[model samples]
Target: MVSITFHGGVGEVGGNRILIEDGDVKLWLDFGRSFTAERRFYAGWLQPRGHSQLMDLLEFDLIPPLRGLYAQHHLEGSPIPYEEAHYDAVFISHAHADHVDYVRFLDSSIPIYCGSGTKLFLEASETVGHMDYGEHLYKTFRTGDRIRIGDVEVEPIHVDHSIPAAYGFIIHTSSGSIVYTGDLRRHGPKGEMTEEFLEAAAEAEPEALIIEGTKIDEEEGGLSEGEVYEGVLRVLREAEGKPVFYTQNRRDTDRFRTFYEAAKASGRRLVITTWTAHLLSKLVKDEHLDLPDPMRDEDIAVYFRRKRSGKYREQDYYHWERPYLERKVTAEEIRRRPGEYLVCLELHHFPELIDIKPRGGHYIYSMSEHMEEEALEEELMRNWLSHFSLRLHQLHASGHMGRRELLEAVELINPRRVYPIHTEHPELYRRLLRGRRVENPERGRSYHL
Candidate 1:
């Protein structure tokens, strides 16, 4: 018997973790962390109340608490625990933060199986001083590459995602096969390659399809990153006032170009903070995407505004190197007039910047769903829109698959015992794939396979 358990991201889109066991052999699929949901419980010294569900997501294997591999001495607030349990191997699908952030949490000594690009990103994060993660124990493989683990043979099947070089894993045993779609979609520059991978898997015809439903509940299929570009434009075009594009910091260059085009069309200044500037710089370094018309320093504005209740505002324009980006401002910009700006919620200085009611300001919350969107009342999103009096909107697009496509994916893989890991709506997948024996392994519980 082969057993799979959901540690997190079941009935949720992120916190991707799963433990697979056969006989004495036990290993993991993806050990990931979900920041947005964790923030709900532990943000700003406020311990959230009424969390029956939060308790459930926290449970891991008979699951010991995330090990002390991550030294939490300097870590304050909720530093997610590194799951350092003993395992034969840990396989990674991609390098997206949600799927990969927990690397710092895990014991650094374990070997991780991933592609070149994935390892490149994991190393880059460590090299750039983003996190103090230990060196990775990585075995690189191309698509169709297979690695042997005791009695199990794990094959890598490439999948197309916004990010380059992602894949699904095909865990093979003599009795059956388990194909795990490690956080994938049907769209990308590599979509054709992904389709080929799916075709190959169809040929093999796995017994258990341990797939992901990152966006399985949606009516129309999830929007492509390109569609998100169109939606962001629509919000900016239809809005009555200066548009405020609110979103998370994913390394999405396509979305960045979309913002740039919208800013140019609206004839408003394209303003971004220091972080976005750095991200853009990195994009230029790697991929040759089209860039926006450069803005002068005087045209760019930083939102970390200062409170005028007897205070001197210090400017932090450190490492902001844009040859074309001209209009840059610090906390002092608060006294100036209103202009089209790009600012995150944290930078807006609370009600001082937001509560000053304005009719034309369009607020687009491109918030990606986690455990919170369904469980919590939109949390920070609701608070900011209500506080600012700005016309609230959702120009966001998901990074996951929709319901119909997810079913189609299950059909394509043709697994015997289907296990849904990446969806909070695992029951949805359970119902959709009727013929297969679907299992939602109870976290913290042990099963003999």
Candidate 2:
């Protein structure tokens, strides 16, 4: 028998941990953190201890307390004895924090599998101090590759999402084929990839389907990637030669491309942060992404803030960051030629506004609205904009399928049993996918397939 257990992602938006056990062979789909649960106990600087991260999280049941799953270092002083990994492998769907952050606590011996592009994102993020996933024997695969472990043969297929190189999986277990849709969209720039995945999934005739319902509760229609580009282009045109600032997820290459093209069309050079410049440099290796090389692209400029000595010294920045300094654009340059640049700025970098001093510029919020925990941050952001006399433009395109498209995809896949995770309202799937076995999974409960 093939049994699956839900350790997290039960009636929640993230923290997706699904364990599949077939005979003696066990594997994990995704080992993401529970943002909602973490926020409940910790906030701001009051985070888990660095040395005892696993223990602190397990104290509140934030992570699953499974034997032989965590690294020995993380279990240094814990009551649980450390041992070699019992699981065969872990397959990451994408590099999103909600889907891949907690891998740091896992035993190093357990091999982790992900798309080659996802590995690039992870390495870039680690280099920039954004995340620390610790050490692991990583193995990368692409769309057509098939990975075999014990009795399971997993096939990963590319899917259209906000981030590049995202994928869904078709797991061939002893019982039957199980399909897992790791957060996908049908209207993004790579929509055809999603169509291909759906076609293949339907062809497999899987026994179980695990899907994400991030946007299922909302009634609003999702904007296609083209619509987003057009909306942003209109904003750039309306800016009237003022330095328009925008911010989005750092890993979202599609959105970055949208902004890059829009800026080019408007005859403005796109200015990105040093971290973005480094990420782009790494992503250029993937030809399919078609991103601009920040170092060589004349239309792109890297923004560097004065740090440490306050003289923009070479030693102040990391070695990886120093390479992009040749294309650096300081605040004063942007202040003098505001009209010539479309700058990428986030809330943390709002301090630069005092230096740039754009009295009446427009700020484009290219990402989604703030989560409930980010209420105070939003208010602080407004204060900064108000003080700078800047106008806020909330123009964004979601990275998930909307209500109609999500339902349609589910019907088209036509799996025997539909299990919905990664949503607040899992019950909605029962009503939406009528005449289908929609399982509202309970946390920590095992279901036989």
Candidate 3:
């Protein structure tokens, strides 16, 4: 008998931790942070204790209380005694925080498998961001590779998403084939990759399908990547010799490319943060992505903010960021010639507006509409824009499929049973996928096949 349990991503947008057990083999799909659940108890500075994260998370029932699943160091002072690795391996679907952040707690002995590109993203995050995925034995796989562990043979195929190197999985077990769609869309630059994944999944004639429904209840603008580029280019042209500021998910390289190409077309250099510059430098190694080398890209410039010294000294920045000092652009330079660059500004960096002092500028919100947790931040952002007299624009292409496309893909795959995860409206799948075996899985409950 084969069994599957949903530890997270039950009825939430993120925090995906699914456990699969087949005979003597045990593995997890994705170990992600419970963003929605965590927000309920903790916000901002109030967070779980770093050293006792497992204990803190367990105290509020934020994560699963599996005894042998976590690292011994994290479980040292916890009531649940530490144990050796009990799982065979963990398969990560993508590089998104919602899908991969909690891997830090996993036992180091348990091998972690992900796409080669996915590994690159993880490495970049560790270097530039405050994230630490811990010291797990990592094994990278590509699209066509078949990885075998114990009795199961897992085939990973690439899918199109907001971030590059996203994938879905096909697990061949004794019972049957199980297909897992690890967040995908057919409206981005690599829509064909999604088609290829779906076609291959259908050919396998899987017994079960685990899919994401992030945009199931929400109405999308139905904009494509090309459309996003067009909209942004129009905004750039309308800037009228003023600096154009934009905000997007720093990890969304597709959106970055959209801005990069649009800036190039408008005869403006795209200014990015050192964080993004470092990420791009690491990602450039993958020739398949065809991303421009930030160090050598003539159209790209790194923006340096006033840091600790406020003097723009070499010692003020981290070693990873120091390499880009030669390519740095200052606020004064942007203030003098605003029209020459398209500046990347996150919400937290709004204070820099006091320096750039662009009386009338265009600010593009190239991201999803604010979520419940971001309501306060949105208000503050609006206040900043109002104070700066900046015009706001919304131009974005979603990384997830809209309702019609999602339904169409489900029907095309035609799996024996459907389990919906990473969604607030799992019941909607039942209403839409009528006459089908749709299972609205409850967290911590095991379903046997």
Clashing pairs in 3: none
Per-residue lDDT over 74-135 for candidate 1, one digit per residue giving the tens place of the 0 to 100 score: 12233354344456778888777667666654555667788766765665555343554455
lDDT of 3 by residue, 280-310 (tens): 9989999989999999999999999989999
How many pairs in model 3 have backbone atoms within 3 A of each other, for residues 3 or more apart or on separate chains, i.e. clashes?
Answer: 0
C-alpha TM-scores of all predictions: 0.71, 0.97, 0.98
Q: Which sections of candidate 3 miss by over 4 Å? A: 219-221, 370-376
The best-first sequence of candidates by TM-score reads 3, 2, 1
Worst-scoring 10-residue span by lDDT in model 3? 369-378
269-384 per-residue lDDT for model 2 (tens digits): 99999989989999999898878899899999999898899888899899999999899999999999999999999778999998999988888887875222232477888888
Candidate numbers sorted by lDDT from highest down:
3, 2, 1
Which lDDT values do the candidates have, in the order given?
Answer: 0.59, 0.88, 0.90
- In Å, residue 409's CA in model 2 sits off its true spot by 1.4
Clashes by residue pair, model 2: none
Highest lDDT, which number? 3
Q: How does residue 228 of candidate 1 score in lDDT?
A: 67
